[model samples]
Target: MALPVACLFASVPVYAGEEDIYFSDLPMVASVSRLPQRLADAPTAVTVLDRAAIRASGARDLNDVFRLVPGFQTYPNNTDAARVTYHGLSDEDFSPRVQVLVDGRSLHSPLFRNGMNWALVPVALEDIERIEVVRGTNSASYGTNAFLGVINIITVDPSVVRGFSVSANHGNQGVRDYTLRQGGKLGEAGNFRFTYQQRDDDGLKDQFDWKDKFTSRLFDLRADFSLSERDVLEFSAGHVEAVTMRGRLAKSQNVLIGGNNPGWPIHDFSQSSTYLQAGLRHTLSVNSDIYVRYAYVSDWASDRYLNQSANPAYNYDEAGDQGVRHEFEIQHNFVPLDKMRLAWGGSWRNDAVRSDTVFRGMSWVSRDVFRLFGNLEIKPINWFTGNLGLSTEQDSLAGAHTSPRVSANFHITPENTLRIGYSRAYRTGSTVDYRANWWEGSSLNFRGNRDLQAEQMDTWELGYLGDWRGWRMSLDTRLFREKIPNRMIQVQNQVEYMVEVQKIQINGLEYQWKWQPFDTTRIQVSQSFIRIDSEFLDSALAGPLSGLSAVPRTNLDQLGERSAPRYSNSILLMQSLPFGFEFSIAGYWLDKMKWTRNSWQDRYSRGDVRLAYPFRWGPRGGELSYTVQSFEGNHGEFKSYGQPADRVVGRRHWLGLRLDF
Candidate 1:
């Protein structure tokens, strides 16, 4: 647009003086322990999804922007095979207890140990520039699955993305999309950016069936360099190629797929992913600093769920899974004595996985991990502040572990704050729960258990923060309690080497609010209440649960309460009109839930709508939009209990355009 707004002001100034062009009266939150503070002194519970709340939330993937995050829960299915969770321990899909990152690497992959392949998310929400969301569980600063939450993702700084852009989108099932972006400058200290994306869909359709068929293409790049005033550098890379559709989901033993039962052993797999990362920062003074980062990733997938004529000797013939990972990290930050601030780091990771269908042969199959971490923040006076964090981990396949966190903060001014925290976490097993061996030859089999052990948790928290600025408002709150003890579950036909165990507890409250009394209106609200209690502790070595149907009593009793939603709420609104035209709305409320146990899906409320318009020609600028999803029409976000057309979900509309040069 206008040459990226005239190279974003040729040298500087997009937001230098601030007049609240849209939001952010003040904002700074950096994944809790990776430093950068002041979300009322972080330490836990942080959320920020800036960029005018992602352009007023007309979200198109990126998992629908966490449905406006608050105890985040996703799994309403629009497909790219979606899954997301935070406060609700969602199960059976890639989310594996949530921890996601972009700028700080880690996109969690050992081939979907628990989650996050959402069809190869390699960034393209207009290069997302913000999305913090730490919302709890700091396994001592991100080790140990970060236990229940973390979704960092930050982008945009390529000298502020100087120029070129394009975009398009089209509607209804089978939607199509495209994007292209480019940035500039590389002299006088450097800068760079790039993007390319494509999409295809036709996934959730009504009238009984039509399922998850998706396609993707992506490429991303970033570069920055200063290499002077004490060094600075950053680089990133990405690639993705995809195809999707994986049906055969028996709704946990219910068998349904509409129109005279369609979804049969559906297939269509193909996948690819790649990554590269780099980082360097050095500024050894002014309070100290040193940092390093590295990342490498590779992934591949194939499908036809293995059959080579039913295991033609089983060496490999496309079933899926291939992964590689390498990570390295280093850090040092200090202020040894100035009201204190300390950080220490260590990390090393390696994973190699191969699968012929959850582990059979193709070789490669490795795992290694090592970590050490430290965090400290202190004030010791003047309104208090304290924090401590630790992390230690070593694993070849679950062994040594440690995670800890402690905090206290009370500011009561500077807009108010209060907090208390505690944390501990560990969760291991994934790589198909330590090596799955789902032998398909003899009709079926499931086995994996390299003597698994390492699911433990303990958490506690209380928090509050408030900002008024004369009622241009903000408020946040949290209360939590959690407990877990060996929850592994991966069984089929009872249990044995496959896995099963449970013990859970969770109690919670979370609330959020933001308001901008004017300046083209804005409002956001979030709510969550949770309660989950489960017990099965290896039900006598586990039995029962073999293709459910005895309705009214068979998902083995709430079994971890399916896709969560113990209680939830979300509201969003954005407004500005009269000429440049724009408006938005969102509402969601969910409660009743289940995804394959006790088959149910009652509580529901969904609404979404967006409209936009803006134009300019001489210097370029663009916008055009329309979106409607559900909007309270034919809705169903996964229901079960037999013949519900197997998880039906629908309602959609789209139309979009963007341009800038």
Candidate 2:
């Protein structure tokens, strides 16, 4: 690709000097305009991840910190429950199109099939203080899983935390983890923070035929309150519980070669989740603000498997699921003139789901959504900047919709910018995609379609942002195209249902570059280049469908054009090593892809490293670390259907200790 963009500027010059691109030194992104702006005038394309790049990317989860972001994708497995996607339409087991917030609370639930269960993520990565990631299609500022992207996750502000901490991890496949934190001062205008965590693993070792494991636990809390000088209140709560290791193993134990399907063997996939949130914000001057919020969530799961062939119709719990949510919101931000700026909001949500074993005799399959959003931002000259957004949804399961977006940046001089955008999104179909009724004892495999329809997309982009702070470098690029005329495919001619049939198209070019280059080095690089195309919408088959390799459209347009990963890359390097020691390295590469539709994954590579040391026993501060995951040793990013060797991701190794009181 132009020799990796000419070896990344061969050490210099890739546009600089507009006083070295400083908009107060960039980085402000508020999930692409609920109004924090600046990330070169955000109207999409953001990817912050700071907290020192999430502890320099040795990513112990948070879905591997999105593999350092460019068109993200993930698969560290931890025995099922980790899967992230960004430019891909993934689902072998859920990734419902992105949108996973935390501070604003929506974790795409319907009990995880609507996605967002990176092993019950209840935040504890040292309290995360950053991670914006908006990339594209924000469903007009958050609606319907943001239709394709948005992951806010802010955290860390219990009055900027102060207090105790503890941490631990030990690893190598059965990697254990632990954490505890506490912050104080909750009596004079509040401030609080608390956390507890645990994680365990043993997954993907020659991977999948059972005995891959996981365990989890978390509790969390946050508080803030300063309710007077213009109000402020905030609260949070969290929980997560888990156990995983599910299914597979048979074919007379030769691990599947012939057809003697003994697939539901190892069980225990229980899960639990809970959440709460509250907010109030007030400050209606100094350029205004107002806010209100509420949130709640609940989830449960079970896996019920038994039937060592005495076949009572396979004894089903069929992976039970439960779900819940409740939300309310209100917001307002202002400056309505003086070069405009605005943000408006409204929200109401409800969403319930219960399962009589996957909805066969459903009881609570509720849905209700209502939203109204707005965004404005104008800058009228001083080198232009404009943005307009809209959202309006009223979805009682796939019904009303409206999403819009528009952008234009062109700052072309105060540190380089140039953007152009367009958007139109809609996606709503999940209460099992409009009520699934999956039965198995009497055999009705899949069916759900209360006339499901709400999958539309359209995007177009061209962006660039550069800040060279005289070679401390920065860059972000995007060049997209997305179209999804109506895609929602879960086909299976003789049994399954839920169809909207494909159209899909995606074209991409992603970028990210960063460099500190001195003062103890740092660097980052990212790349992507994708292209996908799909088909199968000839009114979705009734025989005259000519191709897609036949039988139920078998390859399904090569599974949506290989499901994203037509080249991918990531790199990170941290440095800072001498006496107080620190080091890092992160790497990834991908090419072969497709995570389902008869799996096919191959070209993947990984590398990770970390080393640290920092100590002081006097005022107590500690750090002592070591990590190595995959270390370029075993690979396979996920693939195991008719297994022919994939799913192995070995190497591992860990040791960490935090302590600070």
Candidate 3:
């Protein structure tokens, strides 16, 4: 902190490109502070991904857009198991540290212990307007589960999506996609838009044991109404249904059910989700406004592993959970003073899950949480500003806790600023961690202790943002440190325990640059480096008790580091060509990443290119494009085995056509 302060006071000049496709914008973001504030004044580090970056990446999946972010990692794997993790806190399947939201609705599945199911996400990439990512802890604004970071996705407004549009894509690796969307003004009223999409793919053919074959269909609708000059209403609904291959194929089985034997077949995971959201905003005065929102979501999944096999149950739904979530929230925004602004909100949520194996002898389990949060921004002088935020949450299982954040910014100039910030965040254990009593063939049983507690961490950051006029570019840099008292990890011996027995510290640095040297050419780069240190607090308690093998984590070493690569960087170059043609290329490189204590992944690099022809005719427009991924040959990004593959990836090609009317 002292050194960074000295550097800030010295006014060290930073060099980088300008904002290319995405620039961390403050005034335009509502997810960071909950109040409208300048990006320069936000309390923490932020990364913004606009629509241009999304389209420029030629990404087949929405998660690919994060490759350009300073500290995000895009692991290439079977679509069902792929991960988009933040700040190096990724270890295995089901990334639960970060919170993901679409239009303020959570995308986590209760049946899976709050893990994000990327396959069933209802929002389509084409409908996204922008993504606001908090690069550090933000539980002070987003609530309890917002531990490491937050990814808030805002979709295109209904009013902006006019007429009708259709698109299709065909490529290698059994890739097939089709989309249809329509938007129009209601009869003398508001606006309504709807979209339908279907995607099918057979994952990497080489890995057959746990093949990644899936097919999914999605549908969503949005309606907006302007009741009067000061009142507005918005309603949205969406549904997704998907079937994915899971586990090994049963060679032979003879199980009797009812009057006949049910033949063993391909073990597949079936998933379906539906959600509805509504919000109303009313203006009370010139500087004050109030908004109320409500959302309902239901998720269902069935897996053979989740069901008890010893009892020979014919029903699979008894294994996994059929869950429902209800959330209601209200917020107020106002300019209380000429130089001060405040945004305050409160919310309540109820979650209910029904499972026979997870909670044996219990029909269902329910939990409730209540949260209150507020953020205040004050600009006393033109060159100095302060932002403060705090949130209090009470959970039925983990009691109550509060998180707070404070930051002070010194404006060397309007285009250059220095910020110093600190925050404290708290995370509650997931339902699976607190209550897990499942049997898998008698020998491998997963049991959960009834006395699991919450975890806490403190973060400190020094950040700088500059827009260099002389160089025709923008640069953003940051240094951060975090310390955690108790981090959660799974302990498996004869039984399983979710324990927090490690004290860990992390130090990191990040840089982002965007340069537009000429109007026809653009170049951008982003890089990040991080280091982690851990100490086992209870070494003796973690060892084996008698004869059974001890917990796998007891032999942990520092090499894992939550499976986050030590460093990662990406570069993008885009150029405009004659005859309505555009050309762009992107390259990504990651340092050696570790997945488990014994498994080490070597460094890998990959690249992609997009070539498109755009044309306009009167009022309608369309584009024809071709994209090639993994253009630089194969490399490994994750440490998964069975069959050796290139880049742990294979070459992919896609041809797409989009038309608008």
Model number with the top TM-score: 3
lDDT per model vs. reference: 0.74, 0.78, 0.74
lDDT of 3 by residue, 134-181 (tens): 888889888877788889987877887888989998999888999999
Lowest summed lDDT over 10 consecutive residues: which window, candidate 1? 1-10
Q: Name the regions of candidate 3 deviating beyond 4 angstroms.
A: 1-27, 76-80, 249-266, 305-319, 441-444, 539-555, 558-562, 596-600, 641-647
Tens-place lDDT per residue, model 2, 352-432, is 878776687768888888899998988877788889999888887777888989989998898789999998988776787
True lDDT of residue 242, candidate 2: 80
* Candidate 1 structure quality by residue, lDDT tens digits, 284-334: 766677789999999888765433334343333233767889999998876
Q: Cα lDDT for residue 132, model 1?
A: 84
Pairs of residues at least 3 apart in sequence or in different chains that clash in candidate 1: 1-660, 1-661, 94-114, 94-115, 95-114, 95-115, 96-114, 307-310
- Best by lDDT, which number? 2
TM-score of each: 0.32, 0.33, 0.89
